[model samples]
Target: MSVTTTTPETTSTTQPKKRRLRTPYFQVVASLAWKDLRAEARGREMVNAMLLFSIMAVLIFSFALELDRQAQEATVGGVLWVTIAFAGTLGLGRSLAAEKDKGSLDALLLAPVERSALFYGKMIGNFLFTLAVGFLLVFLLTVLFNVNLFRPVLWLIIVLGCLGFATTGTLVASMSVHARAREMLLPILLLPVILPVIISATRASTALITELKTEDWLPWIQLLGVVDFVFLLAGFFLFDFIVEE
Candidate 1:
């Protein structure tokens, strides 16, 4: 039996498989944005401050201008956009500064995600915050200004304006966060860059509110769309360099 025994050859069937490294861009972006939203929601500090400031700004405008029916209808666009811009800036500054201060920004950078993902994440988060503030401002302004801001066109303007503002603001904030006076630097850097957006948004919104011809407002809307596209693309491309520095 021992002489007749044959040795069975064993073949190795187990081999280590190589994993293809996937860039978790969308996942990273969504996670980071969600984290910021959760933090902001839990604290409520940024939203509360923005809301209070917007209210105060509206009150000041109401009392300062004594906007009668005609004046209110005429200036509502400027008033609403100005209030939203200021309040939104406050939120953006706080959001980025908190991340920089907490060292979470570094951790985020260290993650195996594309830098553009981080930029989009921050921009989306800021956009949501500003959009909320803008919506609140629209509602309050409509009541105070006695203008019908609930129009669909006005909502579209708000969406476009918010997208433009957030795209530019996030990029500027990334640079300003590293500066010595980040709080001051952020607005200085951001406001100048986003002036085109503000002006175009205000004009487009005004046209919509006043029931002007679409042709008259089309240019402004186009300008806003162009500005948003440029900034969004620029931010996406420049984010990696900005973070590295």
Candidate 2:
């Protein structure tokens, strides 16, 4: 038998290849988020459903209420938050459920990565999808309600609000995915938990939309940020346990 020889050049090349398999934590997060993003871009299933729902909700509300200019400005915040909350819930459930159905979730679980990284990856994908719906809703509201919803402050609130919703939603969706009635169960479990965030976001958006004083809207915005941080912390600490089950 020929003797096995290990050259320095071969050893160095082989070692780097082995190390490459040990992916960095953030790289894992990016890869996972990118995977979901690519799948969503290719399929367009989740985002399209969410967009349709958002559009219908905006149209139905606008037609049903027939709000005057003043009324539109005043009520637009409520409409925006309600649409985001429901649509985000739909996207979140679909994201995780798709993984489960495809057996991809099991493979992800078996990968050499921190569970929290997985949570952040999933949360980032859900956040971006929901944020896209939120932006579309803003544009639709502007066109349909004849209100200018392009205020810098309002967009900031939407970002923070969607961030909070996605953080909490990702965790809850994971928990509900193993259930038979996950579609039903996710919202039931999620809406109640996310009610506080929705309320804060609604109040903040309403204040800003109605052109209230800084004192009026600032408190609500601050509260929204705090709630978002709490949820983020909760997801960070709790997601590992959730995925394990």
Candidate 3:
């Protein structure tokens, strides 16, 4: 029998490489996302607070407004987007702050998985939560505003809008979690940055609600998609640096 000897350099390089390849990237991301979901499911605080806040906001807007068909068409979009923005902001701030408080963020940062995967995992969790809020808002708007928001295109717009919001909001929330006034700082940092998303979503949603031509609303949706892509890129590249800092 011939015996083969492994060199130290090859052993060192290949062992770490094997370890890196051992854990699939998608598995890491899914596990991280599942962690958030499991935590939220156990505590129920995050989703409860978000749903309560959203319902109250919807009720207030429904009662506060006196709008004709044309007015509702124009203003419903703004109301929906505004409520989503605020509720999503609340959710993002609380989620990250809790992680920071529990030292889970530290654990995550120290984990062997990729930083960008961490960002995406957190973002997916936030996206799902915010998407639930968005769906609820749609139904509430349909009933309260007497406007039909049940269209597929409108739902698509909502998905894109929430994706963009989650992408940017995740990055900003991570940045602000270390701040003393994170509650205040998150909105300040996030709102201005996601203005493009809000504006596009609002306009596209309004156009769709009003039964405007495809050309009118399609461009806004496209713009929202582009914004989501850009934010995703920014977060993917910058999360590593931000978490490092």
TM-score of each: 0.90, 0.90, 0.90
With a 3 Å backbone cut-off (N, CA, C), the pairs that clash in candidate 1 are none
lDDT of each: 0.87, 0.91, 0.91
Which lDDT tens digits does candidate 1 get at residues 1-245?
A: 35787789998898889886756679988988999899988999998998899999999997798856866777999998888788988988887789888998888788777889889998999999899989998888878777889988788889999999989988888887878798888888888888998999999988878888989788998999999999999988998998775
What lDDT score is found at residue 90 in candidate 2? 79
Tens-digit lDDT string for candidate 2 (1-245)? 89999866644344434443567889988998999999999999999999999999999988998878899899999999999998888798897899899999988888878888899999999999999999999999999999999999999999999999999999999899889999899989999999988999999999888898999999999999999999889888998888776
Name the lDDT of candidate 3.
0.91
Residue 7 in model 3: lDDT:
67
- Write out the backbone clash pairs for model 3: none
Q: Looking at model 3, which ten-residue stretch has the lowest summed lDDT? A: 12-21
**Model 1 Cα RMSD, 1 decimal:** 4.7
TM match of model 2 to true structure = 0.90
